[model samples]
Target: MSDDPKTLVSTDWLANHLKDPDLRVLDASWYLPDAGRDARAEYHAAHVPGARFFDIDEISDARSDLPHMAPPVEKFMSRMRRMGVGDGHQIVVYDGAGLLSAPRVWWLFKLMGHRDVAVLDGGFPKWQAEGRPTEDLAPVVKDRHLTVRYQNQLVRDVTQVSQASKLGTTQIVDARAAARFRGDAPEPREGLRAGHIPGARNVPFNTLLNTDQTMKSPDQLRTVFEGAGVDLSAPVITSCGSGITAAILGLALERIGHDRWSLYDGSWAEWGMFPTVPVATGDA
Candidate 1:
């Protein structure tokens, strides 16, 4: 598997680079309310050495009613500054839930036009499983300036997603579970309609991972997307329950060198709740 610093890296790669002067590790752990796991408490208990906690909820655009929307540019800059992550730092983000939620933070960095960030493949679980070093002490902090060059092409609004769903020029890929995509299972959040987006293809984010929770190889990722009827030659828009797991699909697309993919920031959370947007039920 490719361990590109800008996309993904393995536990071995992280272990070797942990002591680099410019390296920064972030525990970007987040869990669903039903999961009963507290990300902050988990980090306090034990985490990768020198890793700082990056709260997905707190580091987001709190002004938005929706869950964990991308934070404002100024807010992001201040937060990263407080966290001692800034210009010229190589960031490695890992989540407690293997590879589940960390990619979202990585994508956020990319959205802000940072290129030296990556998600830790297999994440904290695999690192702990390998008996790597852990600690409960907090990291040393220092303020640092972070430059912002927001990349609008990496993000899509609800209006753009609606247009893409109507016009087949761009592929809309849903990363929710099959049951949810088919309207057979209820959404974890209340006040939302069921089913996938019209003309969207389903490719559950978990399917892109292996049993060990590490991502599949590049060829395997390509096969998964193609098997779901995605056109690699064209652009794609990745969506999920609330724009979290959608980044997993975006990461997979990046791993396969598919450079024309963008993420729907509102995702199903906004679309499902809006009675105005048309949603498709059953398999695509």
Candidate 2:
């Protein structure tokens, strides 16, 4: 494995660097409806000092019927600006459940042309459980000017993903749970198909993460992916429920020296809705 860029930092590293002037911390936590937890409410209760809540649902492609399609470049810029995230900021994102939603935010930053970002391993829960400093206080808001330089290469659309399935040029990896990928479980979103793409492989997002919410070692990540029949030499496009967990797959790919991977931003939310799109049921 190559010495990959430090796309991840430990909770200790974050605690030591919390007060760094250039570091901007974000609490990018969201939960499914069944979880019965409001991310905003939890953020208000207690969070890393100076951390801001990143709402996945709100900062999305508002016009698309698809759930959480990537927002337009202008909307993304506007949202980050309002959240005080500007150009040249070294962003560190963390979620309540460690590595979950944090990678999604990191992918967002990368898509917007910001690469100086990392996810906090072992996230807020780990920090709190370890008795690191936290507060119920929200940071004072300051407007920051973020330079908008969208990177189209890091993102793929429904059409591109569909074509990729036909051409078999890029390896399609679905990060959804195995049951969903195999059509054994109903989709979380009502009315969507339960199976995966015609030529996709299932690698559940949880497998990429440890019990503590940190990513596995590089060798382990490579093994996990290789077990799913994903060849790192080929181009990769990751998808999952609405594109959230798919970012985790992208992160894993990046960690394993495969930098030429992109995410299906609309993901199954769009593809599963199209009746004519091909879907494969049952495991390989």
Clashing pairs in 1: none
| Candidate 1 per-residue C-alpha lDDT over 1-284 given as tens digits, one digit per residue, 9 for 90 to 100 | 76899999999999999999899999999999999999999999999999999999999999999999999999999999999999999999999999999999999999999999999999999999999999999988888889999999999999999999888889999999999999999999999999988999999999999999999999999999999999999999999999999999999999999989999999999999999999889899
Task: State residue 74's C-alpha deviation in candidate 2, in Å.
Answer: 1.5
Give the top-scoring candidate (lDDT): 1
User: Per-model C-alpha lDDT, please?
Assistant: 0.95, 0.87
Report residue 117 deviation for candidate 2 (angstroms). 0.8
Worst 10 residues of 1 by lDDT: 137-146
Model 1 C-alpha lDDT versus the unseen true structure:
0.95
Worst 10 residues of 2 by lDDT: 1-10
- Per-candidate alpha-carbon RMSD to the true structure: 0.6, 1.7
* Predicted structure 2: lDDT: 0.87
Candidate 1's C-alpha runs over 4 A off are none
